[model samples]
Target: MPNKTLRVERVTKRYGALTAVNQLTLTIRAGEVFALLGPNGAGKTTTLEMIEGLRQPDEGRVWWGDVDLAQKPAYARQRFGVQLQNSEFFELLTVRETLELFHSLYRQRLAVPDLIVRLDLAEKQHARVGSLSGGQRQRLALACALVNDPEIVFLDEPSAGLDPQARQNLWAVIRQLQAEGRTVVLTTHYMEEAAALADRVAIVDHGTILDEGTVDELIHRHTPSAVLELSREVGRDVASALSSVQRVDIQADALLLVTDQLEKTLIELVNWANDHQRPLTGLKTRQATLEDVFLTLTGRSLRE
Candidate 1:
């Protein structure tokens, strides 16, 4: 199969007065795993739907290679595999049977047994769809999407309800897809998942694209500094007076101090606490992360 480049050009989708996706433009390279990272209602799903040709954009173009998806959805569908956020199957049907049913719908398809084995579902191949666990069900969803042997795969929150081990297993499957030279576009609210699996990520919020880059690039661009976290609350005025502190953010139970000069800030913070007679509980220092970048751009946690 040929790897396909997918592009979303200035896409906008509105629901009455509320814009679900606003002038979002993104280019997903072939054979790479691109993740859309955002909180709930952040237009991640809407953007994916528009690109998948499930919903038409109010104003924009979605192109899969030379084909405009909005104008020729059937052609796009034939080339792209989609796994919706909430995938439901015939409960009575066995895993192999479900794969067979979907395989029949596609002109080009992968062998059912190979697909099952790739997804580590050999033992559960004969199990009823409804009888599988949450992770098993998720694997089955992915298996169905791959049954068509698509060039591009779109997965929306594929590991949403899975446990840690299951999530890792799902990530492995995603990596295998990338290894097989398939273009993968996924939407996720899990920061660690994005950090671990995505080659590049687009951070979206309130229907707009905040930033797009690799995990390290985003952290460097948005949070090019170390963070000093303290459990004790620090007043904004006091925090602002600290030397070398660029910004101070107050969380529920901690004070996050962002600084470019880590040494200077640490010394100043220590002296300030000593002078003020306030104990710095749970003091810790760490490098910036994708989660930090997300909070920096959106002013909210991914789970929020």
Candidate 2:
């Protein structure tokens, strides 16, 4: 078992009559990548802020290892680094100069050049913040977070808007952080991103957790069906004929059929196609994924 580095016990936060974060309890292990997943108003950001000491919980308590965050906020803040979803930086400052400014605030700082390389900012060390692209700015924010050489790090929506290649690069940097045995907690709506990087994930909705576990565990627990997709050409009639399937939907050029009896469904579909002289092209079968689990629990997709 991994060491529990951060613990939140029945913590709740509210803004007037609206409860942004309901009574929530969770633990983040040392050297693990834990993802907080939900929609825009799902209290993910509020929960993260509470743990990071930026906001106080109306009830319950938060502990950073053995230190009580409410009692000693400064100590808790020192133990962890944070990269907010949108942070303000001096537009006129060069990348190197920005690091120097942040380093001054921490008693123990990581090497500036080393952090830049780790975050893939080596070529942009002297580039002004105002001139960097969206991806470059994100990388710079990540670099700034590491200056403290913290035991744990919090990244809120680290990859919100970026090209595919840029997102891939940012993922590589996160993997590097994991390899160095730093506990990382991040919030994201991208299911694939959570699937790729998280050791465990917490699914939240309406200010509460619907499920929490490894990706496979959550999917298995919430989504029991297998997905069989076929080309649009033969999907309509075949879907109507699928007695074993619980649900079927059209997505672009493919048909998504959800069923527990995969073998029986496939055999029937194949036999029907063969008898009708209609070959089913683009036939693919996959197990239920995190997205399926999200839909099952929340009655909506994560993106919705």
- Per-residue lDDT of 166-281 in model 2, one digit per residue for the tens? 88988887887888888899999999999999999999998888889999999888766698888988857668677987777665677877789999889989888888899889
Task: Give candidate 2's error at residue 118 in angstroms.
Answer: 2.4
Query: Candidate 1 at 88: error in angstroms?
Result: 0.8
Off by over 4 Å in 1: none
Residue-wise C-alpha lDDT for candidate 1, range 135-156, written one tens digit per residue = 8999999999999889999999
In candidate 1, which residue pairs get closer than 3 Å at backbone N, Cα or C atoms, i.e. clash? none
Please report, in order, the local distance difference test score of every candidate based on alpha carbons.
0.89, 0.87
Error (Å) of candidate 2 at residue 226 is: 1.0
Residue 169 C-alpha lDDT in model 2: 89
Highest TM-score, which number? 1
User: Every model's Cα RMSD, please?
Assistant: 1.4, 2.9
| lDDT of candidate 1 at residue 64, scale 0 to 100 | 83
